[model samples]
Target: MREAAPPKQLAFDLPLDPRYGREDFLVGPANEAAYGLIEAWPRWPDTVCLITGPSGSGKSHLASIWATRSHAWTVPASEVTADSVTHLVSNGALVIEDIDRPEGREEAALFHLLNLARENGSPVLITAAAPVEALGLVTADLRSRLRLAPGATILPPDDALMRAVLVKLFVDRQLVVDLSVVEAIALRIDRSLARARAVVAELDRDALRRGRRITRPLAMSVLADLGVPDDETDEDDAPA
Candidate 1:
C-alpha cells in the first residue's frame, strides 16, 4: 500500500515594506519614455495622463510613484461614486484605476471628474492593461475625452531592466543575495513584475526556513519549483 503526499502549506506572512517611492522605480529603455512623462509633473502636454502596459510591466508601480509625488487622491473604480468624486477633486489632484468597464455609475462620475479636473487645471493619472480605444467604454463622451488624454505605454523589460528589477526586489526584502544570484534568476524569471514579486516572496520564505542566505543554487531551485525553465533545458533538449 502506498500513501499520497499532502500539498505544501503556504505561509501568510505578508510584511508591509514602505519602500515604494519614486526611488524604488527602475528605469530602462523600455520604460524610460513613460518615466520621462511621469517626471514632467504638472507641465505635461495634457491634463489627463494614461499609463498602459501589459500585466506585471510596472505601470502600477510608476502610477503609485506619481500619485505620491503629486499628492493625488488615487481611488479604484469600485470606490468612486457620483457623490465622492467632487470632494476628492476639490481637495487636490485625482487618479482613477481599474477602468476595466464603464457600465457602473462610477464611469459617468469619472467622466465628470475628468472634465472637472481639466477645467480646474488638475492632472489625472490612469492605469490600465488595455489601450484607451480597446476599453469599449459604455459612455461615448468619456471615450472621446480619453482619446485626447496624453499617456505612455510601457514595454516589456529588456535584460538590463530585468537585472535592475530583480536586484531591487531583493533589496526591498532586505535579503543579502549577491549580484550573481540575481543575474541567474532574472534571466530565467517569467519576465513580469507580478512574477518577480511572487518568486522573491517564495525565495525569502524558503531561505528563512533553511536558515541560509540566498545563493545562485537556491535561486535556481526556487525558479525550478515555480516551473521556470532551467538554463540546462536549452542545451539538454536541443536538436543534435
Candidate 2:
C-alpha cells in the first residue's frame, strides 16, 4: 500500500482592494490635515498642492477623494511625460501620485506638466513619501515649482486611530472580529496603518490555516509569529 501523504496547509490569499470612496476614509488626527487639504479643493493655497506620508498612510485614499470631487483623472509619476502633458492638462484637473518613485525622464516631464497645468488653470494634486526637497529631483525648475505648492503630511496613527484602522481593515476583509481582539492587537503593534493591515492579514491567514475561528489566543499567537511585541507604550508615545 502507498504511504499516506501529509496534510496540505490551507491559505486564504485573495487580494483585498480597499474602497476609496469619500465615506470609506477614516479621519483621525494623523491624517486630518491631509484630509482637509483634499477637501478644500480649488480653494487650495495654490493651484498645486502636495500631500506626503509613509506608505499605506492613506495618501492614495485622499487623492482618490479629491480626484472624484474635482472630476480629475490620476496619472502615476512614471506615466507623467512631456508627450502626455497636453493630454494630462486637458483633463481640467489632475492628480500625480507616488512622485518619490522616479522613472526614466520623469523629472523633466513632471516639470513640463506642472508648467502647462498652471498656464491652463488646471489644478494639480501630488502625493509622495517625502516632500519636494527630499525627492532629489535633478531638475531645478521642477524643484522650484514643487516647493511653491503648499503641502500636508500625514503622521502615523495613534492608539485610537490604530484601533479604528484595525476595525476598518477587518470590515474590508469581511472579518467580523470581536472588539476585544481589536483592542488587544492595537496595543501591541506599532502606530502604522500599514502594520495594522499586515497584522490583520496574518491573523486571517493563520485562522484559516488552522481551520479555526479568530479568537484572542489565536490573535496573540499570530502576533507573536509576526514578531509584534506587546507594548502599551506605543499608545502613550504616539506622535503629536
Candidate 3:
C-alpha cells in the first residue's frame, strides 16, 4: 500500500509588522487623540500619562511607537522596582506596561518611579487595560498623580480601523484575502485589534488544513468552527 499524501497548505510566511513606528500606526477617531498625544512626545501635559483601553485595543502598540520615537526602554509591570527604575530611565524615558494588572507592592514602586522620573525630567508612558483609577493601586500619591493626568483611552476600533486592521493582519501573515471576505469577517467579529489578529490567525490555520481560499463562505464556516458566531448578518450575503 502507498503512503497517503499530506494535506496541501498555502504558505503564509511573513514577519509581523516591523514598522510599528508612528507612521505605521493607523489612526481613526477612536484612537486619533491617543495617537496624536503620544506622537507629540517630549511635550506631554504631564510627566506621566495613562493610556487605558480594552485588552484588544492598541494601547501597547501606541506605547511601542512612543518608545521608539522617544528612544525609551521598556519594562513589564511586574519588573518595575526602585532599582530597576533608575536603570530603565537612563534614556530619559520609559514605557511601563500592564499597569492594570494587580501585583504585590509593584504599584508602589511605580509610584516612586513616577516621582523619580519626573525629578529626572524623564517622561513615562503607562499603559493599562482599565481606567487609571480602577487599577486598585494602594499608594495614594500614585493614585493622585494618575488622576491629575486623567489620561486618554483608546476606544474600540471603528469600521475603518477594523477593515484596515483585518487587511494588515492578513498581509502580515502573507495571506491575500478578498475585501468582501474581510468585511464579512469584520462585521461578524468584535471590533478590536486583538480580535482582528485572532480571527486572521484562526482563518490562516483553517485555510492551510482545508486548502481553501479565505473567502466569504469560508470565513462563515471558520467563524462557526471557532464557536464565534456571526452575531450580525450582512445584507450583501442575504438573498434578494
Ranking by lDDT: 2, 3, 1
State the lDDT of candidate 1 residue by residue for 1-240, as single tens digits.
889554444545777464667877889888998898899987889888888888778777787888888888888766678888778788567777767645463678888888888788888888887897888787899889888888888888887888888778888888878787777777687667777878888999888766677887888888888898786443323699
Pick the lDDT winner.
2
Q: Write down the worst ten-residue block by lDDT for model 2.
A: 230-239
Best of the candidates, TM-score: 2
Worst 10 residues of 3 by lDDT: 10-19
Q: What C-alpha lDDT values do all the predictions have? A: 0.79, 0.87, 0.81
Model 2 error, position 15 (Å): 0.2
Task: Give the lDDT of residue 10 in candidate 2.
Answer: 78
- What alpha-carbon RMSD in Å does predicted model 1 have with respect to the real structure? 5.2
Which segments of candidate 1 are over 4 A away from where they belong? 1-12, 101-105, 231-240
Ranking of candidates on TM-score, top first: 2, 3, 1
